[model samples]
Target chain A: MAVEKFLVEASHIMMFARSVGDANQIYYDADYAKTTEPGTIIAPPTFAQSSAQFDPDYFLRPKIGEPWFGSGKEPTGIKRESSGGGGGGGGGLHAEQHFEYHRHLHPGDVLSATVKPGKTWEKESKRAGKLVFSESITEYRDQHGELVITARGVGVRTERPVDSK
Target chain B: MALKASNLRVGDTHSVCIVEDLKRTQIVQYAGSSGDYNPLHTDEIFTVKVAGYPSVFAHGMLTMGMTGRMLTDYVGDGRLTKYGVRFTNQVWPGDTLQATTTVEEVADGIVKLKVETTNQNGVSVLSGYAEARVD
Candidate 1:
């Protein structure tokens, strides 16, 4: 399976920067940012993960019959037909997320992020039935092609009876 | 005043910093900028009816940004080597958020801080920890 990639522009970054009330010249004032911060104009710390305009239907929404939803939603009956559901039906749950910043991101630094599965393991939940835990890693790179940030997010999919109480 | 790593001990606390009367405009700005249109954060009707929240709330990242600003204000830029947080609760408009930081660990040019934000009633809104590299 191939992981999808997305591109984000400076406008998106600036929008999030403004939303956070970040007055740092680096985010808005390009000249000021260049002069103030060592990099082009350092992006606010949380900016990278913030203003993402991903199409949930394609990028985030899980494939039909995948036996799980993306973050918090329950599994629907739709099936991919292409990718086979491994076993009993269940759903996915968001577990945790971690991010590592290499250096400050700046305006005009086109960013490309790729999200892919990092790891998966099986576990049993007393309440939710059999669960498959997985981690997705999204790596971001700047226009200069440097690794700016790396984010790893964990999710759990359960294979429990839907009507089980 | 610079915060010295050696001066900070486990259980050491900082003065309460209050951000008075957060407004809806700030929340809107955060939503517009962050692309997080999770109505629980912006649309009042949606938040109330769908999410069952009392009112529109601020984005978790916005609250974290405020905390980051506080750390930067105290320690200066480029000094925050490692910062991380977990969103524990939500914050609504007109609420005054009081922030506090407690030194949890210090070693090798790094100081671990347990940061928390609370509402007027002293109920915690956000609680997490961060580590900063101090000179």
Candidate 2:
């Protein structure tokens, strides 16, 4: 996925920090932040994942005039040709995630993300059946064209719903 | 405050209760902010009837995000240079989570850590490692 522009604003960081239950002043209180080490409000560690908000073609978000996969009047808004798969309730599950921070983000940083597909592999599991995992690596760059963070994620598609036990 | 290398030990550990009784509302909040509106996270009917899960579950990123709070609180804000994790189990609503980080190594002004998050039942849900700059 390529996102041309991701505006990192203070409110978004505050909301993201709240959603994750982080109460750190550096994440929300700019006044308090000025006295701290960073000397400014900083984004949370995992905040860069929200770059999906700027991805025009991000499939997980419902686009206008597009039929979503979630429920409407019925159990699902879209029809499925077959059942099963999606262990914890989606097309695929996040198997792994990794991030390397060249620099942390603060409000007002305009960023962009470029993605590269990494690897694909398969594994058999007793609880989830056959699992196919694919990886993607994303590089986030600030407006200055400096690489800010590198993210690697692996997604797994299971043959059937995973056994909860 | 940032960790001082001189005061750190290889096995020094810090733990925090990341979330208690994880709520679906919080999951929705994460979905809204993260822009990952996957039905498996907030749409219980579709998740139960179509996707065949017991119920809607938390996004792996949500768990990671919450765990990140623990990391930053321990290592100090903006101190982390690397953080990564593998989802080992599903996190459902009503589950309490605890995250722990152990110092694995500290050298050259950087500290390496072993990170693990577990559910109330002591089942490991996420496991990984992190590296951070220290004072």
Candidate 3:
């Protein structure tokens, strides 16, 4: 489903930049950014808005209870294996990610990010037993209703359930 | 400043960027603001003992975000049409990452770029490309 999200404040961009612990003057001093090469403060690449996973109404979120990574009811289709480590396979891993920007994002851009279900599959793994792979595709449109960014992410989970040892 | 779209050719090159070293505390702050509390990244004990890893590591997105810094610093407010990277390796504390971009193509007012990020050992942590409007 396509959902809309507001930037809330231009400061969100700065906060994200600071959170990353990057003291790049451009992300901070607005006047410096204004006089510099780009001539304006702009969101860093992979800015907070580029992530649909952060959206409260994202698709992976089940309508019922607290958000969980695996299936809500039970794990059925996922292959199960009890082998030990060797293939770097693990229950929890962020396998891959990609982001495409149609335009730069400014603070306060009311962006709508629509997360559409993407291709998912399973493969064998040596370390984590079996690995399930999935992607959630999202498109971000700015306040003017122009597509500004497209984000794609790959999620990987181990066949074994998360446990404490 | 980003080069004019017209000035970008397939072989045009942007200088390399050396990012600040990753500190221990930034990991926690990032988790707080980004709302991603993956223990593998934030909890030292979890990473070393629970996860059976050597030590706590920075999020790939954090490195990717620093790579994003390279893009923004170079393009200066230019629009990025596409930016993506595969997390090839982990960035440990005290590792200083660096990245560089090359113009791959220019057409229809779009400048295509290839970006690569590497660690102090010259080991690649992430690699990808991006397209942005510079004209």
Give the per-residue lDDT digits (tens) of candidate 2, residues B13-123: 999999999999999999999999999999999989988889999999999999999999999989999999999999999999999999999999999999999999999
DockQ of each: 0.22, 0.82, 0.31
Instruction: Tell me how far the alpha carbon of residue A141 in candidate 3 is from the true structure, in angstroms, after superposition.
Output: 3.7
For model 3 chain B, the run of ten residues with the poorest summed lDDT: B44-53
* DockQ ranking of the models: 2, 3, 1
Q: Per-residue lDDT of A12-82 in model 2, one digit per residue for the tens?
A: 99999999999998988999999989899999999999999999999999999998878999998877755
Best-performing candidate as measured by DockQ: 2
Quick one: best lDDT, which candidate? 2
lDDT of 3 at A1: 50
Give the alpha-carbon lDDT of every model.
0.60, 0.93, 0.67
User: Which residue pairs in model 1 clash with each other?
Assistant: A15-B33, A16-B33, A64-A79, A64-A80, A65-A78, A65-A79
True contacts kept of each: 0.23, 0.88, 0.40
Candidate RMSDs in Å, in order, are: 7.5, 1.2, 6.4
DockQ of 2: 0.82
10 residues in a row with least lDDT, candidate 1 chain B:
B45-54
Q: Candidate 3: where is the Cα deviation over 4 Å? A: A1-4, A21-26, A29-40, A49-54, A57-91, A123-130, A142-146, A158-165, B5-9, B15-17
